[model samples]
Target: MNRVYNFAAGPATLPLPVLQTMQAELLDFKGTGTSVMEMSHRGAVYTEVITRARESFKRLLNVPDNYKILFMQGGAIGQNAIIPLNLMGGARKTIDSVISGAWAVKTQAEAARYADAAPIIANSCDAAGRFVSFPEFTTWNRSADAAYINICTNETIHGVEWYPSDAEAAVVNASGAFLVADMSSHILSRPLNVANYGVIYGGAQKNIGPAGVTFVIVRDDLLDMQHPLCPAAFNWRNVADNDSMFNTPPTLSIYIAGLVFEWLESMGGVAAMAALNDAKAKLLYDFIDNSKLYRNDVQSKYRSCMNVPFFLNDESLNAAFLEQSAAAGLAALKGHKMVGGMRASIYNAMPIEGVRALVGFMGEFERQNGQAF
Candidate 1:
């Protein structure tokens, strides 16, 4: 089989080993005479899968004892509403969101349905609504009783990342507001201080396993504040109390995520994955920075290690660049339509060699187009 390097943002490339392991167990998992997908979610075998997966995920992220990781079916978009619904009941009706990019903006719009959302245009570049820099935490106009502070830590579309430093954490902590993070693109890529945020949620398509599962890690105290109007299944407290089985969970996706957790543990966990991701990102970003024709517009400090978005100096060459990339086995090099440029999403499963291949292809394309490399 000809395997092209897939640069898709979600439903992205998974580790080959994880896929092979799943394939090996597909038809009859552990002598059960039934595929994992075919098994009862309540049965002992599936229960074991759930328990181990939760433990492995906690270990991978160093989740604190206070955090409850709930595996749900709705994607991150769902949490945009669920977050406000669950957390806004005890506080003022307003929710403050740090608008960074497309996802943050969308999340704020979704939250508006359930609460009064105040958008703080934190840091956005004039061109393409890119989030190249974040507003200084001290400058943010936070409300005293805001339900929570929402941040899209990694914006997949604009390729911006926010790794909150100690000072930033202190600022947020001082505001008397809960810090909620949408970490869809960069989850499991590194270790996160679970104590720093009130909630962290992500769709399990990039760094995790597949598209169906959405992981929500909420601090126990925050879960107890669900609104009376919140749906039973969407209530974090109920979901946590029921152990993520308030409704029929996404069983198959959870099983796949379990396998992925095992795979991450085998790879020496998140620290090792962070180092690998850093190397991959550096190779591509360094190449782009040096190239005369290509440029990555994101601020160096805030640039995402997971998704690298760049543009050809000559916009006319965009089609040629994509065509050549496809011919060279580097597929899906097109940037999101909202941000018209090329984006290479080098997630956990994207090896350094893939980055090297992409860099080499970019160099060749630049040379052919008579742009100095």
Candidate 2:
């Protein structure tokens, strides 16, 4: 059976080519006669898989040699605690956080439990309690001696992204505090200046592969900043030193992530992906802007290309729209309850075909239901 277009947040869809490749190598990986799931992570075969995965990831991101790429088991949520535990060990207990939406709110709240977490400029919800734009950096109440500044580059649930200009990044970097970011939803969808960030992390499900693997790229110097209470396995230094194999790692997930990295490289790397992603997002957003019955409230400048949350003018038609969209092979269009209507998470795995299919369905749905309201 043909697969329906999956737009759920994550563990989101993956490339069909990657899935097919994994299927062909499922039971006997490269003549090793064992599934990636069954192989010893320490074995030479598995070692090659993970090493190549890391190398491909580095190549795609242009990660500096001063940085270490670690494949860990915790999702982004795990890093909520791990970040503070690792970074807040110095004299500065403050971790200044930029709150954009749901994940940003949660990231700051989680950090406060371990350190002196302070909100920098959180305008996550507007007067109408909707997240439409990111707060300007000038308004940030950034601490002078904060350990690091945590920013969720993309708000997964609220369809807002922070695409800072080079000048804006220069201002942020001037703060002297370490720059840490959660790029879970849009990690490899664009090119990133790895040098600007002291730490950048993301869960693999959305763009890379399945759940169970999380990638954290950190500056070499920050690895020594682990809190005394931080678990040895979770410590960046311990995990990085051990090559992300402090214990039984997420071998299967990492292997699949390896396949994803190779797939991305084959498609001319992140720059090509960024251009395609821009086109897809523009198509959907332009349609939404012109629609009579649908609207997206996110500010044009701060809109997320990875996730588009939209609403029907007639609120009651939500269920019908979702039902019809599913029947038309467009699945998981339901929005998060916090800001409900519909959210189509067009992550890196979601092809332009999927977005075109969704736009076609939306147009048909508007025609069918517009006159009644």
In candidate 2, what are the lDDT values of residues 293-318, reduced to their tens digit?
A: 99999989999999999989998898
In Å, residue 82's CA in model 1 sits off its true spot by 0.7
Highest-scoring model, lDDT: 2
> Residue 265 in model 1: shift from native, Å?
1.3
Q: Residue-wise lDDT of candidate 1 within 25-90, one digit each (tens)?
A: 999999999998888888899889888899999999999998999998779999888888887777
- Assess the local accuracy of residue 258 in candidate 2 as a C-alpha lDDT between 0 and 100: 90
Listed per model in order, the count of residue pairs whose N, CA or C atoms clash below 3 Å is: 0, 0
Candidate 2 backbone collisions, by pair: none
What TM-score goes with each of the models? Answer: 0.96, 0.97
